[model samples]
Target: MKQYALLVLLTGLLSTTSQGQQALTREPPLVSPEIHDNHSVTFRLKAPTATTATMSGNWMRSEGFARPSATMQKGADGIWSYTTDVLSPEFYTYSFTVDGLRAIDPNNAHVIRDVANVSNALLIDGEFANLYKVNDVPHGSVSRRWYNSPGNTKRRRITIYTPSGYEMGKETYPVLYLMHGIGGDEEAWMGLGRASQILDNLIAQGKAKPMIVVMTNGNVSQDAAPGEGSDGYTKPSFMLPQTMDGKFEETFGDILTFVDNNYRTRKTKAGRAIAGLSMGGYHTAYISQNYPNTFDYMGLFSPALNNKPEDHPQSLAYQKLDLKLKKQMDNGYKLYWVAVGRDDVPILLAGIGDFRKKMDTIGMTYEFKETDGGHTWPNWRKYLTEFAQKIF
Candidate 1:
């Protein structure tokens, strides 16, 4: 009986030793999406059971690839990896497909919501992309301020960016009202456009003046973005309703009044600037036209100038758009800038062309810029970087 007990103990000790040896043989999980000095990136995934793995990312095109997805090779240990060629410096979104299911990189923590989909974000650092990267510089403060919007009859939120030293000093800064496109709220510019980072890097490099950037919700109906303040209820669409016609223009004064009252700002037209993307572009054009002399600098980014007579149907406000534009010219504004991506949608390009024709007829002077790419965030961010340098 003693011998039998000794044999059982020996067997148990041998099993424990073997398990320890196996644990030591196993490799550690890699730091995925490892960025190299050469701008090439390697993505890794440890899926012991996945038979096939593939990587799909926006970087494919940037890397001179025809397709976005690249097949990853599985090693003997079941770790899958793929290294891409040198890519341009910018933020890129990517995901992995294991078998047939698409999933974000398990090792990557940076993620962003682009429209309805979520993916991992990889920042390739270089050149203009460096502007989007947060560096060790004097940073600014961003806040979501809730205020009463009598225009929509609800409390709305505006994302405001006050530059570094705003709290320490008693100086008033110029105000730039930067707005987002449709399907976006006040958070769009900061999140997707990386406006704060752009401004921070620019200010640090003495490229842009230190100023206050205010991002407002352009949607006329909703007080804020769905899930912002209204109990997290998501709506179906972001398009403006016909019922809210002419409400935005009438109630825009509320936003101005609130900002001027609460923040330390220069109260003159020279100290004010308004700029926007897509639908926000339409808003900038409309506001600048409707309220001439309100802002000295106006940036229309991919402006969707809806000047069709059939759409507005001789509405006095619509008919007066040209007149308001003329008044802006007569009032002697500092900068009237219009920019659009060369590959923008046909509808927007057409409207821009029509507006340019009108401006030509009225002899209104403005700076026109043609950027590369379509209606994309990259283009908008580039526009913001360029526009900021030109403004106060």
Candidate 2:
């Protein structure tokens, strides 16, 4: 009996030892924080007990390939952090998926108004990022006003960028309603997307036209993409009607109405246009297609229009014949441009082809840009430059 008991105890001890060894072999996922001083960026994680942690981000335009240790520091309740010397003015989308807990920076105070939106930090400067920059230029002054939606929804902020010559020149400049994707606001495109600077540079060199560009938030559209039901990036066609125009859409739409009412320019379809980046690009396409009379030109850069109305995400009857997607072939719009990197999202390559095929089948005229660089800003900036020149 004693011998049997001893054998059982030995077996239990061996099992315990093996489990401990396994625990030591496994590693906890690390997240190094990213930071930009002065409301631009900076990251901090409260982790007092952690031994080691690091961060990963694609901020360097490295073809969307994450560069580990973009910034990191340890200590402070296991809190690890990294910060950049006041960064150049721009809006950056990033998250600290620390230990597998994907989250936004809590220490940072600046926030982009997005619902269920991926959290990214923002840094504003006195130049293009600041409304004051518009005033500094020769022709027009940048203005921001609060726009109210129905249902007592809180008014939203809208930013407008008019050329240095807008007010003084007796010219009704064209309007480009540039938009930001999920996790962005009105300031993103003009600030980080550099809409004003791109236009300024282009106009200075005689490459772009002097136009009144409107930057707005496009998190929610009236006609939601099918896959958007999941509340993340997917084939929009996969989304259902019940999913379209959810709460998020309601909020963003308010911004759109505000822009139309306040901006001093042509409000007709030909004078107004819309464009966006990433999710913003997708929004531009979706909204322009659905609201054919609103915009004369449409620009989509690195657009995540993965699913057309009927391709992969055929969740609705409209997906079959896409009576809802007739906007994809709207002839009333003047210009439509779709640009994406070769390796942006190989998964979406098939979707892009299908979307183009549908457009071709409809005999729609549009520009398709396949540029170098992955899902980073090089292609996006370039796309904006070209799109501006053509639209303006």
Candidate 3:
């Protein structure tokens, strides 16, 4: 009798749920960010009750980190729409402000999370942006693997991209240690930077060699990215503990050991390269110099080279910078490529200048490339594409 009663209750609940779901209003299907032949794009949103609407995107001119916004027009049919001038070929992200509230395009399925904020992704294919797309080529395998970090006393996560045919072949490949910025995690390069797509396209076009790309979380305090760690769904922050304190660089050996043991790697400095953006750039500088013979190629993309206080615990890492450069030079390396945008902040420009002056004093031979934009993912992606082609 009790079982029958429970079954009747379950049936009633399921019927109510089905009726409620059926009664819910359904939104009309709409196409958004419609790209035209001339590269002009039209964006549409259905906000019938909204008083005001605006569109903001990375493609627009940016003052520092602020992107310019465009006012959207509301039609008599209650749809908000905006059209942009011919845009350059690049991957861009955008969001809409409807009635003063920030919202992503409901029709766009492709979205990326930048720290805490999520925005819709749009790719205008052509020129350099072609490298960012997933082309018709043999693809690579990207995996999220966990390794024990003895220095940090925790199990850490890493994102590794193995080139195509890695599993079927017995050949060993070179390795690239790619690092992210202050607020990013291991997924940053693969997601926002599109490192795998860049590599696959470059390798398919015979512009780059097929290798293993290892992306590590530079934050020593966290074992993994926000929700992926023991701390569940913690909000991400630009200011995190031990990001630039040199502990992450100190504990990088754990990642190296984990990769070498698991994957079929070249296992030599000649077959290794390291590159990073922003805070990761600072890390690349320190890690490559501190372990002078570990990496043969180094790329610093908009690296933060500011000096820390003398009383800091890891102040020694910042101290004797010239001696470390000399040691790295003496040990010999294939490439030391430095790139920074002209529009980056004055402090970063000055920091890069000071670091370059030190390198000049030590007579270190390196390649430097100045781009047109500021500290952004576009610059970093471009640097990675160029750097990957140049390395083993």
Candidate 4:
């Protein structure tokens, strides 16, 4: 009787499999976000009865996730489809809203997280994005490294990227401490920015030097980013407490020491680079200033500037920062790069202008660039591509 029952179960499983195959033959699978050779993308959804459908993404002319960039047209087959004009090569996140409900792309499985927003990913391979894409080049290895943070009250997780030849070679490499903005964690660069792939392609193409890139969770109070660790300290808040209060610098030296001791690092200031985006830019500004002799290369991508009167050059805070900047300049450094998008927030633009004026007044030489986009990942990734090539 048991054998008969088992046979019945196996027959049911095979029958179900056959039915699924038959259904597939009757209805073809929908191919969404199909990219053409010209970089145009076509998106489709199998919503036969939906009254309306719209698509929104970061690649749209307007920023943020609230606005719909394209409208979908219903076809005779009850499928809604929309095709975009020729787009540049880059990674983009978008979603479809059927009627009044926003939903992820059912056809595309590659999704990306931006703070609290989750959207389906679209990749159009071209110049820089090709660098971001996984080409035939030798790739690097990335791993999560947990270390005790003396500054924070918990152990922190950092994402480390080792170049392709790192495992077999005995040579020491330079270290670039990469950072993300507010609401981001150690995985931000690797996830949204595609840092590891960019570096791998750059190194393979002889565009960037072989270096170990360390991405740290800039949130001081949190041990790691959301859902990244077993610890219960992964909550992210809008207040940005640790960074605003200057707590990130307190235990930064410990992280540096750990990296130097554990990894095959150059063990010198000249071989170190520190850079970040937005809030991370704020940290970079202070970290490079507080520890002038630590990093020989400093990059600020859309750096958050304190534009208050009290933060001006004549103010106490500005005076101290000025002194450190002078010290770093005198000690000799490889590069001091500040880049921002032309369409960035007006206040940020004002801040960057003020900072540039101060640097000019102090006779502090540095490079400044204003790119095409606003305060978004596209600009940040472009900045990294350029900055990494310029650094040692």
Candidate 5:
């Protein structure tokens, strides 16, 4: 027994020594994204066996549904590196293509998913991008809560952002129902949109009011996002069922009920706001008009308001639009904000022009903002930032 115990002790010491040596000999982590003072960024990857390497990023112009890529040069030390020209201060996503295979920066853990693609996230902070950063301010609390959705016959996930000091105070705050695009889920606003950071910064700067921002999954067919639902780890698609068919707009009451019941919200039209991007903007329009008196402030960010097929059930929501708009206007609203990019898709531009003409014919007052850029996250973020400040 003594010999056995002695042998065990020797084995333990040998294992510890081996682990220590291994730890000491391990290669140091490479800094793939090295942001310089001049705002240029250096990206590096260690791929000695790779025949070719290239970096594709959202910063580059899109070439027929594909992002432009830059060639990366390899060094004698088995590391491929590329330095970008002085990039604009913004949040960008990038991926590396090595030997014909797409790859994310293995060294950078800051990754985000957009529809089916996953890429590494990089923030070049200076001007507007600074609003997307987590500044030293009283930060709000973001919670991922499941709410019972009777319309979908399942519990769905919703992300809520209660402003700072919400839990400690008994004061009731206004609510902003911020919806995501067709391809996005509840996590979209919190991740890509940087809603919390934008809100926190604006509130801290006294530029915007403190309110509860609720982000819901606009895809009513699915209860939750890809991995968060019962359907395990399925790949997300750009298009999903019942996205723009008015099903989500019909069932929006479930979300309102859940939020108002659980949170300290002012449940009045004057204290409620609804906004969204792309498909979400369509939802905002329908929900505001259908409900008539639920929300006072409405923001449409590059909305997809193209006319639907007359035979489709979705067209029911679009029918009698003038009557609905008249009723909504009669009901009284504080702000109806419509923002679109000057370079957005031609279809969207045509739709917006038609909608504006209709509004003009009916004498419905609204604030129209035309900005530079196409339908992208940068425009969406800018819209949110500007719209939040205007609302309660």
Candidate 6:
């Protein structure tokens, strides 16, 4: 499948198309089905050789098949067809498991990158999901903008999401500068994350304040220094933050700078916020420490740096928050929330426990939250929902 997803906002509801079967009846089964009209999907695979197949992921936690696997039928050209039930309008990940071998369908064009093996991942836009238009509130739109970097020429792309009321209303909202982890680009928030619609639902329900979110691709390459793009290529996750020889702080600074200048931003440090997931969470912690004046709130979700050795340079910075910075953080930081999943040990629960201790030693204040989900977007999304409700 093509990488780029078509953005659309549907306004009306269409009746179910099936005649003999109810909308709830067995769905058309295929490999990678794009969202067409309703919250339904049709998938097809040219697996003439395979007998049994299934699709699974976060949507229906595949706990020993809580989700019924769709049955496939052979077509004239040896294509197999199956359809997923009317799933909620959200992006999902599924692989077609054949007879007994765990493998992706060869005919599914949707593929996940960096996977050594094939992945039957597909993109289902909001229109296809049907939720994009359900609440009757206008949907938000995101724009990718470029700005001048202080000392570099390779331009970077920053994807900004503005709520429905942004342009039409006179109110100015706080800008949240969101960034993605090592391998993800600016699309991470909108694609798999569906930040726009999430924010739309929250704001419509008055659960979250209407605000603008800017997401940047945060992987910094050796050849691409601060204030520059890595030439549309991702540097290995290990090579970043030149000072650390590969940690991803310097490049993040440039991204923040660009965001500060290009948009009709609150522009002041108190009016700004920064956050991310995994690698992004690490960046949030690292940058908040160094650039004390740039953000009013800092949220770290499943932070990758959960457990760097106490002597690690990054840990050293947290330990020595400095009197002036510590006082400032104490005085103004609205919320400094750090969250981790109970099942996550990427840095391990003990790591964050240790990190909390270090913060306590330095008298640095923050909120630590725990959830049951592992290190995945569900946790990340829920973190956004909760942390956002607390932001100033």
**Cα lDDT listed for each candidate:** 0.83, 0.60, 0.91, 0.84, 0.91, 0.64
Writing each residue's lDDT as its tens digit, candidate 4 over 1-392 gives: 99999999999999999999998887787999899988889999999889999988777765421344678999999999988888888988889989989888999999888887778997888777897788999999999999887767678899999999899999999999999987888989998889998999999999999999999887777777778776554545544555545567657886898899889999888799999998788778778877788898989999877434233344233346667777767877778899998888888888888888977887788899888878889889988899899888
Residue 228 of model 1, lDDT score: 81
Itemize residue pairs with steric clashes in candidate 3.
Answer: none
TM-score of model number 6? 0.68
Which TM-score value belongs to model 4?
0.90
Task: State model 6's lDDT.
Answer: 0.64
List, residue by residue over 84-156, the lDDT tens digit for candidate 1. Answer: 9988888777889999898999889888765445689878888899999999999999999988887567887
Candidate 4, poorest ten consecutive residues by summed lDDT: 309-318
> Clashes per prediction?
0, 25, 0, 0, 0, 18
Displacement of residue 282 (Cα, Å) in model 4 is 1.5
Off by over 4 Å in 1: 1-27, 47-54, 60-80, 97-101, 233-246, 306-319
Tens digits of per-residue lDDT for model 2, 1-392: 99999999999999999999999997554443444346435566776665554554445445444434464677655667766555555445555656555566665554442334345554354443442133334343466655665632444456688877666666577788777655555656654465666676567656667778776644333222223223445433323232223233334456556665665677677777788887677667666655656777889887766644444343322233444346545546678888888877675666667777877877788888887667665467667777887874
Cα error, candidate 1, residue 338 (Å): 1.8
Model 5 over residues 237-347: C-alpha lDDT tens digits?
Answer: 899988887778778999999999999999999899999999999889888988899999999999888744233555556577678989998888999999998878888
Residue 85 miss distance in model 1 (angstroms): 2.4
Better of 2 and 5 by TM-score: 5
Model 3: lowest-lDDT 10 consecutive positions: 307-316
All candidates: CA RMSD (Å): 6.6, 15.7, 3.6, 3.2, 2.3, 10.7
